[model samples]
Target: MTTKTFLKAGLIGALFSAVAAHSALAFPANMTTDGPTNPPVGHYEFCRSLPQECGSNPGSAAPGVLTREGWKKILEVNYEINQAVTPMTDKEIYGVEEHWAYPDKVGDCEDYVLLKRKRLIETGFSPADLLITVVLQPNGDGHAVLTVRTDRGDFVLDNMRNKVLLWSETEYTYLKRQSEQNSGRWVKLQDGRTVAVGSVSQ
Candidate 1:
């Protein structure tokens, strides 16, 4: 890896080294189930926009083990995309129903997470480690964030914040997430342990 990559990894490692120590309070492993499903239309469009990644093979690494280089790549992609993209809803940007796609100028939460995941995958972070996760905001609005699984636990990369945080710190109720093995697939991520944060039923 290059010097930049090494520095990025070191930064991420320093920022998230505590996660693994606190993993017991994080989302339970049983919450996620496995299955291949259809990709959302906006994700489909985004995939069409980048055919190379859409057709690429999945990563073979064990789920959630954070290497210094991989962790740095995740932080780099998350921070870069969060700073670069202006947040706007699908209605404002596309003028229609909920659409999840990569943004050129402005896009909503889902769009932010999509681009982050795509970039991380492109940067050689395992697709299995990077997941697109959905949650119910405190106000009951449906929201999306990128979940980077690590030995430290699942850290959330949100458009609203530049820092990568454990999912428990985000104040959003866990709903569902993309399957580890495939980008096109999704799985429900709720268990009896989940705390309701909003009135939204998704």
Candidate 2:
């Protein structure tokens, strides 16, 4: 074979190998879950106040299919909600701590999560795909984010940022999240981190 043809074939093979290696190291399509876990105090109370929002589904649940249009919608909702809601603690807003409810003008992290989940469901996303996840921030404080499970992977819609990122990409320690089979149930994440659960606030 000509030197030029041989060189071209060698470069193509190298490119394919590199791509394969990168794919192997890519983040998992789904986060691993352990046994059932206690729901966060705020989420428990929220379910009590709004039973309709936390009903259980009987059958198996599947992650939403992430298409170009769906991705665009997720971006829009994340950006809009983050921009619209001003962060405020429960003590400041409701004279108590750890309250989870839909926000009007201002709310804490969990509140932002709730609103985002609601909006996504209304926009044709499956309720099973929208999970309320509790995570431990870098400072050891508790925080919440909306975990959107799609065919591609689990992406986080955080109030702290408008950009949607994969669960593995975030710096926070994963704790637990709402069950895909049942919205009212909670499941512990396999993230091997132990720390005191601090008060959750924006």
Candidate 3:
């Protein structure tokens, strides 16, 4: 599935890691099997940073120019090279699935974003720019999206697709920025159609 495809329904229940056909995969490389690892405590502009507010600093999650190490960090994903994430896959991370339930090689979309955000912070991206965006696919399906604010603009990291794409490059309409609201929870988008959150649409 395309990045937007999986994201539209909070997918990523499975991860297909292939070096050739699906080289770009794995995503955040979360800390534990339970779920995504949270960012360091020092990073939060305040407990009220995400959804509750835009954060004290505007450019927190923005990873503009990555250093050599930082680039490596940003690119690092959860892949066991030479090991089969699946029997058919050759490389570490092949790709990801969103809607499929009980995804052995996958997880929820939130996990992907959490891992990505954590790794970026370790590399040097400010915690502010990385916004957790809940959006609907062009078809009005549910999903989650991570927006990495850059000096140029925002780059979207998705589990469904491999390479990162700009926000505009993807078709999913922006529903609500995780850091924009005070409740720190998912919100509906105006002017655009509505989609379910955390659930797949038939």
Task: Give the local distance difference test score of model 3.
Answer: 0.43
lDDT of 1 at 164: 72
TM-score (all chains, Cα) for each model? 0.75, 0.83, 0.47
* Pairs in steric clash, model 2: none
What is candidate 3's lDDT per residue for 27-119, written digit by digit as tens?
321111122223212122323344333334453332365343433333343221111122222122335332212124444554455556655
All models, RMSD in angstroms: 4.8, 10.1, 13.9
Prediction 1 global C-alpha lDDT: 0.68
Comparing 1 and 3 on lDDT, the stronger one: 1
Better of 1 and 2 by TM-score: 2
Write down the lDDT of every candidate, Cα atoms only: 0.68, 0.78, 0.43
Winner by lDDT = 2
lDDT of 2 by residue, 1-202 (tens): 4333433444324323433444665556578888788888888888999999888755436677777667767777777788789999999999997788999999999999999999998998888899999888888788899998876678898999765777776888888899988888888887543443533322
Q: How close is candidate 2 to the true structure, as a TM-score?
A: 0.83
Sequence-dependent TM-score of model 1: 0.75
Question: If ranked by lDDT, best first, what sequence of candidates would result?
Answer: 2, 1, 3
Model 1: residues with Cα > 4 Å off, grouped in runs: 1-17, 23-31, 34-61, 191-202
Off by over 4 Å in 3: 1-73, 77-105, 180-202
Over the full model, what C-alpha lDDT does candidate 2 score relative to the true structure? 0.78
